[model samples]
Target: MGCFEDLSDQELITAAKGGSDTCFGELVDRHTTTAYRVARSITGSHEEAEDVVQESFLRAFKNLDRFDGSKSTFKTWLLTITRNQSINIVSSFRRRALKFFSDHEEGEPELEFASNPLSQEPLDAETQLSLKRQYHTMDKALKKLPERQRTALLLRSQESLSYDEIATVMDISVSSVESLIFRARKKIIELVER
Candidate 1:
């Protein structure tokens, strides 16, 4: 694995196409965390993000032959796949939530935030409560944005993708990416100000 680890993405892809699972495994290892980050930013749930990452890699593996090196880097291609998969999953969840609400003739279901078991450092009681409140407030503001603007903002601010990269991943022009991010930031500020 060390021998293949230093290889460039294109090189790994070439080796993978030649039937080397190790090469593909290396590719997955390299991009999995970033994929999860982008997915989490979109879906806002660790479990859902993990599901999207799994499905995205599976689809990528199946369609490797169709990938064209001349078009985009492997990372960009994989992200585009991850973005689409996560968005689709989120959209499906919204539809289900809507149906559930309609059936029950009630308001939206309460969402439970899963605590991070991996966080080992203990915080003071007041600090913990303050951080939790801030996190929830920010999350609520983000959720109020339109989907395109939210996704664009997450890609730029959370994932730190360039405008061109966001454009490619979101299938829009660079100018559109800028516009979406600008509007998203403005809306988030307005929401958070209240």
Candidate 2:
């Protein structure tokens, strides 16, 4: 029943912490798919999403008593943990991969494409496959943004969290979140709608 949806998040948290396994499972069931989407978007891998969700719940359960209902909501807390874990895992993998390449290429000079000798029209490749590739490519480009803008965009767009909730999770001023998200949206719209 969507009756569970009718309950406030704090209500769910209390029920779950009061030894209601059903409530906790309900919470997980309600959120897991969305959590995985958030993780996958952050980490850019399905396997990492699976691992992040599993690890996030494990950590959350262990610290159940540490949760105080007053501050951040349960969803934000769980999502924050999941997102952080995914970013750490992805960043670590990138660092190791870069180091491997660096060690292997010690003697070779890096290669660069000299500015296209001919400035040909770059638009011809917007084929059917290219249309499908656009959003995914744009998401990675979003990661190239500054940290606060990226975080703000992901939470709002992927998790559907409100700006106040995002501000609390990010420990930033509400105005700052608003501004970051505004700038992020402008940049994404500029790229995607083009």
> What is candidate 2's lDDT per residue for 6-71, written digit by digit as tens?
677677778877877666777788778767767766765566678899888778777878987788
After superposing candidate 1, which stretches have Cα over 4 Å from the reference? 1-3, 93-134
lDDT of 1 by residue, 1-194 (tens): 33356799999988888888888999999999889878877877777788899999999988999888888878889999999998888789685786677764333333334344588556666666777788779889988888789889987886688898899888999999999999999999999998
Model 2 is weakest, by summed lDDT over 10 consecutive residues, at 105-114
Question: For candidate 1, what is the total of clashing residue pairs?
Answer: 0
Clashing pairs in 1: none
Name model 2 segments beyond 4 Å from true: 1-7, 93-95, 98-134
* Total clashes in model 2, counting residue pairs 3 or more apart in sequence or in different chains: 0
Q: Which lDDT value does model 1 have at 119?
A: 83
Tell me how candidate 2 scores on lDDT.
0.73
Q: Least accurate stretch of 10 residues (summed lDDT) in model 1?
A: 105-114
lDDT accuracy of residue 162 in candidate 2: 96
